[model samples]
Target: MACRCSPLLLPLLGWSALLLAPMLLVQFANAAIFVDDRGVQHTWDESTKARVAVRAGIGAVSLYHMGMREEQLAATWGLWGVRGSDFDPENPSQGSIYPEADPSPEEAAFLASAVNLSPSCWKNPRGCFQWDDTAEVLGMRDEIDFIVNIDNGSAEDSYNAAEEAGMNVIFIDTFYEYNENCRASNYSIIDTSFCYGRSMIDVAQRIEELAVFLGVEVDQNSLNQQKQAACDAAQAFTETMKDLHDKGIRVKVSIVDTELRDDTGVTTASVADFDPIELWVPRTLEELGMPLLHAASYENNEYGYIYSDEYFPDCTPGFVNDTCNGNTYFPVDFWLIDSRSFILIDDNFKLIFPDRAMLAGQYWSYPRNDGSISYVMIESLLNEYRTRLGSAVKLQDSTGTCTPADPKATAHLVADGTGGLGLNEFICYDEAAIQQEYLQCPTVAPVPPVSTPTSPTPPTANPPVPTSPNTSASSDAIMVSTITSIAAAAVTAFLMFCSTSG
Candidate 1:
């Protein structure tokens, strides 16, 4: 049966599953399971360790869900693995997989075995595996309750041996069974999105499934808490987008594989609601034209051909390693794409600093064509815009993906320094005009005089320093440009995936 949840769920409960024995239930109700060094007996068994792991699992699951919520927010600007990113805690696929151990050892030992992973997946599945190989080799495979996975070869032979020894063999292929649906994010009872961030409902159902398999029952209140947390997160995420909308910083997004349709690697909806670019996506096969770069593709030194050594040097371990350089790293192949692009899906997007935010020493900061030195992170950009423009930069109202409906079809939004901004459909984009406006930013101090009154005396005049970037070389005009700046050759957008040993 589907788990029913209450709205007031939070402060998630941390507890072991309630054993389904009627005597155990009576003991729970009567408080009869404890002793004080008296003649009373305490429940002490190797299996009882799963209880401790179960408690820790609650915390791990909560962190994983929170990471998922954060991802939904970050996807707003298409900044997944770049610009101060946080990887999902449950699914350790993003940057550093070394320190992050999601599944508690107890859970790892309870119900599963690890095998040699698919050859394509580095023999280690990121974004996909529930447990890392370390836990598997650490004796987790020695303690399964029942219902273990089966394979056709050596793994199958072992399974047969175990079954002959009176162990029940239950066949399950969860990885392949739910992989496609999970990737597509068709969240439902049957097929749920896995590692990226399992939803509350998804987690609850999973709990129930595990309970059935283990012949245990979960606390209904705990189930409700999980569900409630999901709803609350969804509500909070929606409000975040709405806040962006009122401030006017929402950009519409229409994600596309740039190389497939055009070799130029840039195609436009020609819509102005978003200054969409040609997104750069690394791929395994250039002929297949697949843009989504999976962890599997990076195995076997293939990804290095696309991304340069300067970008993703052999010295740097993770796809991104800030300890080495603050810059986001991808195979050098990402640099060749014509333009960085995205269709803003909603203003509800946000950039979040995860629990590890404090650990991060630095994020990439650099000068842009806009003549401002700023951190390239999404939150940093949004904060800067809000501080300077009095309102967040917003996309023109866009209804959907088609030109008329898409954010791209709409006019570009331009803010007038007089506490106001407007959409410009007639003019494509006035970059120079915008730069000129930045020079006179009311929020950024005050506008400088077009020309200091030509002093009557040279010594007293204090001639303007030519080095000042705010001033022009040929002309003395203080006008700003609304035109878009030149974008990087390609975007560093990437989606990570992982798979467990079958």
Candidate 2:
């Protein structure tokens, strides 16, 4: 009457459940999504179908001046950061020094001489004063993330517009043009032409007089106020741009003898009170401590002196070396936008570090008065960086598809080759692109469905007739019981016999 048990059934049911549970867990984990504090979400290959896309942008100076409408600016330069100065109520157009309808012969003569002597001077006199025209003629409006205007009065408004459009802006100090007489042409109210007409010492004394007239502290009987005025004007400009800090825009100044504080009243300690120093001058290859170098046009051959070379040897034109030998403090604001500065570094990097490094910078960033060599230089540099760096990060590119030659390393991206270029030295973008591409590519092999094993069919239920059993079940039980009883009785009898014998 005892129930018969089937041992195979228990194991079959338990193992089937165990295997199924793990499959379900894995599928659930694969389906989950996570996001970061910045609102950037992480997506796995399986979940990235509709969400994955590219970002494109540009970097230009005075972006609005490029004839790009607010919407166009947004579409082209939206992803980069915002910068530049606000339009000045005092001088609208952000210190844009356009030539008056006509200038005195003396003034025109000085400007002509400067244009001829200064390497940066435009071949055409009228072309230099036309920002909008330059932008149109150069076809720059269509290219760039945002624009950075140096000592531009309209920098803030331009930056705000850029921010709204999702672009970045930069404010360069006037120091880059301080030594250039053309600055007076750009800012005619400065009376630089008259000052330059005198002896250098007399000019210096006149400058001191002007600074005193402006109510700024100056050396007793010294005429260095021109320098002081330029510095003060720059400091004021920086302060004005710094107001946008709360809104997330960046402002920067350049290194100039004026910006360098000999005035004990405004020492380096107080310098931090204003805008943050953008670039540290005296940049040396040995001191960069970085694997990649970003070069602008002026950094190219013979044009290298436009940028500070205190840490490099031979600050002279066309001479490229590492480190500036002198110990003067150099500010790095304008260097970021100076096209000439990039050219020198570009050639230097190519010649020396071709195996490991590359350079990138803005193309068509400003309204180029002369279009002679920018396009050719830009393409050459781009190709050079790509070929040399192989695969490295291009911080400026939005596509993020740019990859290195080697599949294992990172590559740089240039979102819009028109506006800016970035040196992704760590190959950050290359590695990311590879991972993304790998995850995105469809598998060639077909995935087979998981098969559930079935239990083998048991024998038919028909009872087998007693082939040789001889009706054993009925008699077998009775015989087994009888044998058990007899064994027990014999044991009892033995114990009794032992007791009697004792």
Best by TM-score: 1
Query: Residue by residue across 419-462, what tens digits does model 1's lDDT show?
Result: 10122111112222211211221222234679867758547567
Q: Per-prediction TM-score, please?
A: 0.26, 0.18
Best by lDDT: 2
User: lDDT (CA) for every model shown?
Assistant: 0.23, 0.25
What would the TM-score be for candidate 1 when compared with the true structure? 0.26
Question: Which parts of model 2 have CA positions greater than 4 angstroms off?
Answer: 1-154, 158-290, 293-338, 343-384, 389-502
In model 2, the Cα lDDT at residue 465 comes to 80
